[model samples]
Target: MVRGACTLTAERADTDRVLDALPGLWQGFSATLIRDCRLRFRRRSELANPLIFFALVVTLFPLGLAPDSTLLSGIAPGLLWVAALLAVLLSLDGLFRDDFDDGTLEQLLLAPQPAGVLVLAKIVAHWLTTGLPLALASPLLGIMLSLPGHSMGILMSTLLLGSATLSLVGAIGAALTVGLRRGGVLLSLLILPLYTPVLIFGAGTVRLAVEGAPLAPWLALMGAMLALSLLAAPWAAAAALKLSLDG
Candidate 1:
């Protein structure tokens, strides 16, 4: 009976320690998030590159194809998704390059908080700077593609959710290649295949919305994918970062 009581007391003590650490962990996360955002914003041109690429690809598609509104509308879903995917890819090569160059990444790994938490903060920052802008600008691009007015909301919604997953998944590739001199091509090779499902479901959701079909299933799938990525990608990326740095 005495031993049982002692065990319970120890468990409660550990629980209290964890509860005490929660606020500090949250502050670390927020500070990292804010710092990343401010640093990215400082480089105004780099911050705009993905958005520019996204717009240019969407704009040029109409020029190369027949100017039929129905045809443009038909292809818009896939085109937007592919373009957005590539744009995200283009920005990913530099995700960890700056940190690695300046030795900040090594410090991040040594911090008291888990590396995954800091990496997840960076991923969120990437989405805020890159993916969020793409989702917001999609409506104008959708109009250019002659997409149905009602379907624009769906396009934005899918991009918002899909892009978060992209940032998470892409971070793994970025972490893996951060030590490479020229890992851009290698990064694309590593992550492009992984991106196929996101492309399919994201575009499919928009297509269904255009067709006036029920899109709840597609959105649900996207949410599931985002949830999985949220849970797993940060830890995977953190491990990769450790490997890259150690090697």
Candidate 2:
């Protein structure tokens, strides 16, 4: 009986320690995020593809549409947002492919920390790689597109928020398709409809800027969408990942 009591106490102690550690478990975010960034940066082609795609789309639009600043300026907000959206979509297919291939994805799912938090960190790292660069590169593209110089801040701001939301939304689709051999095409199809509203508000925000109109309402909506995606996407992604694992 004494030995049984001692064993029960030890088990209780182990459970208590795990519960105590839960508070600090979110630090896993930093570790996973850093690791993701390091791995992505090591692959130069993967890191550069979306940025190149973004720039190419922006550069081609004015030539294709005629070089008139009036025409270009009118379409610039939608053009920029569309290009950035496609760039992110292009990158989304590979978001989980590497980890899924090498088995790190399995480890992540089984980790002591919540899988949702880990997935969120990874999505953030992806945005830092694919989305943030697009946002930063937009001002130069804004110039080429003949967007009003005064609205350059609006261009950058909208892309920053919109692209992060895209990354989060894209992660859910990527998780759903990660196990497939040719998921890229299907991934785009799955996520693009969901991406439409973000494109609308994002482009609208910049258009308001170009028109010298109040941007607060549009910007506020984009911010709300980002907040909603941040809160909900990780959990949805984790559930999708579990389904992938089960399959």
- Which candidate comes out best when scored by TM-score? 2
lDDT of 2 at 114: 92
lDDT of 1 by residue, 41-64 (tens): 999999999999999999898899
Global CA lDDT computed for model 2 = 0.92
Tens digits of per-residue lDDT, candidate 2, 70-145, equal 9998999999999999999999988998899999999999888899999999999999999999999999988987
> Model 2 compared with the native: what TM-score?
0.91
Task: Identify the candidate with maximal lDDT.
Answer: 1
Q: What is the TM-score of each candidate against the true structure?
A: 0.91, 0.91
Give the clashing residue pairs of candidate 2, or none: none
Please give the range of 10 consecutive residues that has the lowest summed lDDT in model 2: 17-26
CA lDDT, candidate 2, residue 199: 97
